[model samples]
Target chain A: AQSVAQPEDQVNVAEGNPLTVKCTYSVSGNPYLFWYVQYPNRGLQFLLKYITGDNLVKGSYGFEAEFNKSQTSFHLKKPSALVSDSALYFCAVISDTGRRALTFGSGTRLQVQP
Target chain B: EADIYQTPRYLVIGTGKKITLECSQTMGHDKMYWYQQDPGMELHLIHYSYGVNSTEKGDLSSESTVSRIRTEHFPLTLESARPSHTSQYLCASSEPMGNEQFFGPGTRLTVL
Candidate 1:
């Protein structure tokens, strides 16, 4: 079974400051990692995915993630955080057994203070 | 943009009442999924379908059932609504071999 973990339950950052949310995943063989964001009372929206190539993947809203195969981590990052960027972030990955489904992390609450 | 839609954005029902949460997508994706999500938590997959007339349970055990009668319609039903079943239900669809899964607005079901 493949699984992902978001170590921090919540991350608070000052507006315009850089922010980072940590994520680590465990899977058999190679991994296909992804990032999703959920606004209040809304379903998750796709941000970006790391299927193959490009260790550093860029996503929507000027977001980017670095996939570290050695550490089994794919942490989301943004250089300048905006108040509007505050939301719930989730890291997910597909199972190793050729399953069409994805296993998601517990989610990290990002709060950007103005 | 993903054109997936979930009806009854909010639903409240009494215990023992039977109800169905409707999910539809215009993307014509062969794969569809249903997930139960609580506030400030990770989503747990309840059910999924490969195509018409195909449905399978997900990682999490759920009392609700789902049916895939059409390529774009996947509805989840619960024979008896229980307070424990109250949560946000999300519908998602993906291409036969696509990487990203497009999600709907989600239906918040509250069983009293």
Candidate 2:
């Protein structure tokens, strides 16, 4: 079965500092990876996705993720974090195995302190 | 803008009551899904539909049942609400074989 793993439960960083949230996946075929952000009492907003080609995919809100095939990782990153960036982040994966629904990680709480 | 909407943004009902959570999309997408989520946790897919009159259970086992009678509407009904069913229910839609999904604000249910 295809699954995603987010190792960190929470990550704290200072405003303007670089931040990273780690993610890894296990799939039988090529993976379609995605990053989503959720604000308090709000639905998840799509950040970006990696279907093919570029290993580094850029997303909304100045976010980017690097897909490492050999390592089975797709980590979300931002050059400079803002206080408003504090939210819950989820990493998801969908393989070409004919499954329509995405397999999501446990989620990581990002706290960007001002 | 194309959007998905969920009704009863907040609902508090007593246990054993029957309740239905409604989801609709104006985007005309062929696929719609229902997901359950706890606070700051992973979302579990409970139901999905590829089109009208086509509904399927997802990865998670859920007591809620859903129907897709119209392409734009997908309503999930729980015959008897329980404390375990108290969570946020999210609705999403996408095009056929599309990777990106648009989600609704979600309905938060509290079972007392």
For B16-111, candidate 1 gives per-residue lDDT tens digits of 999999999998799999999998799999999999999999989999999988999999999999999999999999875438899999999999
**Please, what is the whole-model Cα lDDT of each candidate in the order they appear?**
0.93, 0.93
Fill in the DockQ of model 2: 0.77
Candidate 1 ranges beyond 4 A from true positions: A95-97
User: Against the hidden reference, what TM-scores do the models get?
Assistant: 0.97, 0.97
Candidate 2: what lDDT?
Answer: 0.93
DockQ, 0 to 1 scale, candidate 1:
0.72
TM-score of 2: 0.97
Docking class of 2: medium
Instruction: Write model 2 residue lDDT over B1-112, tens digit each, in one string.
Output: 3399999999999999999999999989889999999988899999999899999999899999999989999999999999999999999998755378889999999999
| Cα lDDT, model 1, residue B10 | 98
Q: Could you tell me which 10 consecutive residues in candidate 2 chain A have the lowest summed lDDT?
A: A94-103
